[model samples]
Target: MSTFKQGRYSRYLKPFSYLVDLSIINGAIFFFEINITNTYLFSLYISALWIIISFKNDFYEVQRYTKIVQVMTLILRQIGFFALILYTFIGVFKQPNISRLALGEYLLLVFLLVAFFKFFIFYLLNRYRAAFGGNLRNVVVIGDTEKSRQLINLFKKRLDFGYKFRKQFIIENDDFSLQKCFSYIAENKIDEIYASIAELSNKQINKLIDFADNNLKELKFIPDNKDIYAKKLKYEYYEYIPIISLRDIPLQVPINKFLKRLFDILLSLAVIVFLLSWLTPLLAILIRLESKGPIFFKQTRNGFNYSEFDCYKFRSMTPNKDAHLNQATKGDQRITILGKFIRKTSIDELPQFFNVLFGDMSVVGPRPHMVRHTNLYAEKVDKFMVRHFVKPGITGLAQVSGFRGEVETDKDIINRVKYDIFYIENWSLLLDIKITVQTFINAVKGDDKAY
Candidate 1:
């Protein structure tokens, strides 16, 4: 069995940042040659004051998901406090003879150096995580819901954020017990636990809090509707209907949407030009030899906004009346030998590049379902409709994560919705490229679930 490795040194990063920030502060005093009567005494006062101000402002409490803009705001706030203290020191000690120009230069110099240091370290850490996959936190979600699953998805999609997802434990299930979850956390060395506030009882929540505190694990809660404003949930007004959001979705931003669309258009056009341009005709001839049907299979699948669109694929099954109603099962008699080959290699899905090009789909998103299946799952699944928030895709996170093909049971469909929701909640350009590359590798390796 594999063991979960937690990030042991992250606890030290905060103090290390403090040390560097203080050094930059005192070092600037001499570097800028600020004139003062007793430089050492003033340095001591400023250093102590800096620490107090930083604590009051929560300046050093940077989290993994803290944005660059937030850090800039922190820097500005810290500098303002520092300026106030400098003037106060002059007033208290009666040193008006000090060179005002020199003090101004000193303040300006410290601000520049500190801002550069903070930003440089921030950028470097992100790059290191992205390139080398280090500094990771082993996290587990304690409840299964839209908000918990959204956080789990964020952890998976944002590699640079440095969270390694372990598992999600459903509290609503009959077999679930706090003892089992506690044992898993201990054995797996989990670093964090995220529980949904709506799912846990008061007693269970208290137990979890005690367990996390005893084990030195971070505990966070997923806010419910009632606790949205109280818990600082993102609030937006949608035509007078107040809405609360759990996280900031990148695809919801205008620029991110444009960039993803541009990427889909370029990549779809390239595939249609280079691979599908020749392969489509050859597959057409072979498909004709095996069965008497249209060269391309077209069916209505749910697209963005619950809209129906004709999704195209190379015909892989024999002509049948149940084609639109039934999904292809393993060892189904309707599939031809060529169908099996094409489906395993994912050649049958190549024509959907045209769907992507036509703007009915994206290069990566939730895979659309047949119209009947969509209507059924929308009723049966918890967050199935959330998949319709973004354009459907030929291949998706679910497919690449081994949730593709025939649904053998309710668990299969449920897991598919989990990953689909995760993809929608945490869409990123890097994630799309990663899923696409993984899809190709799975195609070449032949997925057992492909049929």
Candidate 2:
């Protein structure tokens, strides 16, 4: 219906809705006019202003998948704009025809009436669509990606959104080409073309755009932010050049970032001042009693963005050349008596609180990978490197979820990467708090793979 009508019937709803709004406002003014005896002309002018404002803001644009909140916001913003213009006009011209209290009531009544009408029409429209109305637009999604798949699923789940998927063309599939894409659309009454812009080649994108334009089809592109972990993306023109802007990730939002960092610092400071301050000395004595090495072991590991940072831990093994290269096994004899006990109890990781204080790590995030392991896994696993997009932590969702310990199999690291990415994508204060509590619980209960 989008391509066939060019939004014909849907477009008419705008003028119709606007006309209803004018009638309500005029009626309100006519009833409430006590001091203002000649409100007919004033009502007409105000109605015109309302219509003009609604048109300017594209309030009547028919969007099948639009949320109800978006509709409410549009109406409220339009009213705000109208109120400002009306007040300025009256103030500057010194129009003393209106009764302030009556005029206020009139405006309030106008708002209420219009709001009721708009929502009532909205309910009718939703019901109309739900009955498999003819306004449904047939769309073909091109590209197999998280965004593309999600779009397809949303359309399927929401029949009231008035979208029907004709076909899905995956560029990476066994048989997919521009010719095949054209043929697929030719067979169906496709109204809109949705493509994953990042995955499509420039020539392919241009062809799709040109086809949509010539055929009067709507063309929409889904952005790729999985790699950059962009929470929000905005497309706008900067002078003549088109630009894509990446908004702040949830954790990096100004207030959230400040609070999270402040919390990390204070908690780390408290632990160092009280717990670690005394416990470190006792652990040092035990560590040094068995091994002829420093009590605290510091080794460089991959942190946020794969940056190397000195991760501190109590010495849990005899100093070895493969400190960062080799993974600690079940019982390889590199561990001393005291070292095994501390490693199992996870007391050896207490020194990393200083790393959190030093801003090298977070209290909760994907566990920092050894530098060698990071390079080794980056090439083998898909989206494995995405874990580096955030700060590494001493314990993480992956750790507490039992994806911890040595990566003995490919599946081990795969599951770990999945959880790590999930954490990165859905990070919140509550999520961090939950993970921290779980980590504490797991430490006390003891994980079999820890040693």
lDDT of each: 0.81, 0.74
Could you tell me the TM-score of candidate 2? Answer: 0.51
Best by TM-score: 2
User: 113-134 in candidate 1: lDDT tens per residue?
Assistant: 9999889888888887777888
lDDT of 2 by residue, 154-233 (tens): 77777777777778898998778977787677567676677888788989977775555334455767766534534455
How big is the positional error of residue 18 in model 2, measured in Å on the Cα after superposition?
48
Candidate 2, RMSD to the unseen true structure: 18.5
The C-alpha stretches of model 2 lying farther than 4 A from their native spots are 1-237, 240-248
Candidate 2: pairs in clash:
none
Candidate 1 at residue 190, lDDT? 83
TM-score of each: 0.50, 0.51
Each model's backbone clash number: 0, 0
